[model samples]
Target chain A: MDLATAGLKTTDHDGIIRIDFIERNILDEANIQLIGEGLNHVVDAMDEPKLVICFENVEHLSSAALGVLITASNRVGSKGGQLRLSDINEQILEVFRITRLDQMFQIYDTSAEAMSAFS
Target chain B: MAESPGHHDERRDSDSSRSGVVVLHDVRTELDSLQRAVVDGIRHAGYDEASTFAVRLALEEAVANAFRHGNGEDPEKVVTVEFKISDEKVWIAVEDEGCGFDPDAVPDPTEEANLEIPSGRGIMLMRAYMTDVSIVAPGNRVEMVFRPAG
Candidate 1:
């Protein structure tokens, strides 16, 4: 089931799939839906079990967007697969800290580091 | 009987003394403008980047809760937002036209059993980012405050 997800950029690194998000800010319902649907596509298209979501440019992430991440994490976990994050801005990292999601998701300094985690 | 969208208004005091009120329909399209106005207002009030980010995050969460849970995404309903910036504090309030829930009853999202649950984290993030979070008007309205660093 291929869905239209213009908000995300996908790349294949070895066997790990890396999804770099282009949306710098995820605020309104439309953008939130974009992230949610984009992740759904990634999860569904996972011939490989490992995935890394990079927030290199996303400075503002609303709780709604966080909900999308949580849902994606759950979907990956259900398949005995892993989902991780990289390049999170410091300000946005505070949000993850406040919610303690930093503990739930493995976070790294770069996409390379996150990709290496799959090994 | 649905009221048309774009029927809302925004009012800023003539003095422009770092305070204003924005009344909006439950329309989702209006949120982007509201958030931009609030962010610009807070920045103009001399909040640093970190403080501004925290306040903005909390404000977005509160407003999203009103639109999503409070009004059940009913465009006919209304969501009223009020914000004030003082010398040392920034305050925001969001009220929805739906029957409110008990904030106390929301379980902690950080709990191991609840980590994967996505619904309850909005309230938790609001409380975490804001200096104070209070539910008023029978839980229909949420008020949050942020105290800036010196």
Candidate 2:
């Protein structure tokens, strides 16, 4: 299922799914649910064992959105897959750094670098 | 930006010259609008970008806690939010109409065992982003302050 119509764009590179946000901020509860669903769809459709979420345009993310990301990361991990985040803004990066989530996920400067890690 | 009209009661104290009060019901959907209002007020007060972001993060966490944990997501309850911004600092208080918990008892999210847990990070983020975070009025109210970085 392509969740791009649902506010998220997805691309598959050799079985590694890269999900991008069409919106700037995933702060509200409804958008969080949509992002979660998009992630779950990507995870469920994964023919390979890796998933990458790109935050290229996401500048401000609420903690509720962080909760969704955490849940998605755990879900992928439980399935013997990996989740990576790339191109996160500094402001958003500060949230991850403050919460120490930067230590949990493999972060890259760009989506290309993140995708290349799967090789 | 001027205040957006909604169901909530809003008051600005012209005498004090630097305060705004917004009382909102515990409706989850209102969080985004409330956050935007607070952030706008802070920015309009001449706060720098970093300071505004800090205040925004802290205030969001506090209100989220009031709605989620304190009010248990009950829409019938109310969350009272008051903010005062000055050249020195921004002070915000959020009160919920539900039983409150001990802030000290919240597990540290940065701990090794609690890293993957999703729930406990709100308080930690509030504390980390704000200059000071204190539970007042017998834990029913959270008061946070953010000062401009020197």
**Docking level of model 1:** medium
TM-score of 2: 0.89
Q: What TM-score does chain A of each model score against the native chain A?
A: 0.90, 0.90
Residue runs of model 2 more than 4 Å from their true location after superposition:
A1-6, B1-18
How high is the TM-score of chain B in model 2?
A: 0.85
lDDT of each residue in A52-86, candidate 1, tens digit only:
88898788888788888899998898888899899
TM per candidate comes to 0.90, 0.89
How many clashes would you count in candidate 1?
0
Error at A111, model 2, angstroms: 0.4
Positional deviation of residue B81's Cα in model 2 after best superposition, in angstroms: 0.9
Ten-residue segment with the worst summed lDDT in candidate 2 chain A? A25-34
Residue clash pairs of candidate 2 = none
Candidate 1 segments exceeding 4 Å error: A1-5, B1-16
What clash pairs does model 1 have? none
* Native contact share for candidate 2: 0.50
